[model samples]
Target: MYISFLFSSFYMKTEYVVLQILVLLYDQDVLTEDAILAWAREKEGADESDKVLLQQSESFIQWLQEAEEDEEEEEE
Candidate 1:
């Protein structure tokens, strides 16, 4: 209950809000480094925090890549 409430609150904040936006934008093939960084900067209020978002974005991409690879391996 506590963590659920915390997560619900977190989605209301600027950083998480921006991250969600970036995720949706990426899914729609409109995401770019400049665009994501710009949003992250506006939300997080620091360039360094943009790096954190970059890392998170990269991790999400990597997970998607690995999931595809796994599916291919399973099919073969």
Candidate 2:
């Protein structure tokens, strides 16, 4: 039980780190959405939960893009 708990905690923390990296890449425009998706899909031990998190990250990127566009338009 202790081992399982430790593994679960480690997995959750790793997932959080992965999500943060994705967001950072998005913010930097270092990777396109397709590239990000491909990279996530290629990650070891990726599962449905990871897919869900990726979706959330994509949505966030989309939101940020739209917000930036809106600001640019407002300034024009």
Best-fitting candidate, measured by lDDT?
A: 2
State the lDDT of candidate 1 residue by residue for 2-36, as single tens digits: 99999868755755665677678877888764465
Q: Backbone clash tally for model 2?
A: 0
lDDT against the true structure, each candidate: 0.63, 0.69
Query: Where does candidate 1 stray beyond 4 Å?
Result: 1-12, 31-50
Pairs that collide in candidate 1 are none
Candidate 1 clash total? Answer: 0
Cα misplacement distance, residue 10 of candidate 2 (Å): 0.3
Per-residue lDDT of candidate 2, residues 1-76 (tens digit): 9999999998778767766887788779997766754555564357776566665465555665577678889999
Instruction: Tell me how candidate 1 scores on lDDT.
Output: 0.63
Q: Model 2 segments beyond 4 Å from truth?
A: 37-76
Q: What is the C-alpha RMSD of each candidate to the true structure, in Å?
A: 8.2, 6.1
Per-model TM values vs. the true structure: 0.36, 0.48
